[model samples]
Target: MIGVNDILSPGMIVAHPDRPDWGDGQVQSSIGSRITVNFREAGKQVIDGDRVALQLLSAD
Candidate 1:
């Protein structure tokens, strides 16, 4: 498990496998075991529904 400090904040890029094409995203919220991500798609930032019950990708 990774601490909140381990994960970067909003505007920070992250890797999300669910969005393989867009592979990068800006953090929106981190709560419990889930992290909300907003990915840039077609020149627009949209909420990615890949947040629920996800594992942290941080190196502990």
Candidate 2:
């Protein structure tokens, strides 16, 4: 199934829907359902696009 994360790409800023404490994160990479993000507080994290719909903060 298609998801919002399917539109995410590198350089985009996003926030974890569940982990607000993680702070805003930058899209490092997105391949298939795997998304790598570098958060201000959580550091690098691998998120499953199929599971978590990251909230878009900035397109650039």
lDDT of 2 by residue, 1-60 (tens): 766699999999999999999999999999999999999999999999989999999999
What shift in Å separates residue 4 of candidate 1 from its native position after superposition? 9.1
User: Which ranges of candidate 1 are over 4 A from the true structure?
Assistant: 1-6, 42-60
Model 2 CA lDDT for position 53: 96
Q: Global lDDT for candidate 1?
A: 0.49
TM-score of each: 0.46, 0.94
In terms of lDDT, the poorest run of 10 residues in model 2 is 1-10
RMSD of each: 5.7, 1.1
Which candidate comes out best when scored by lDDT?
Answer: 2
Clash count of each predicted structure: 0, 0
Model 2, CA-based lDDT = 0.96
Error of 1 at 39 (Å): 0.6
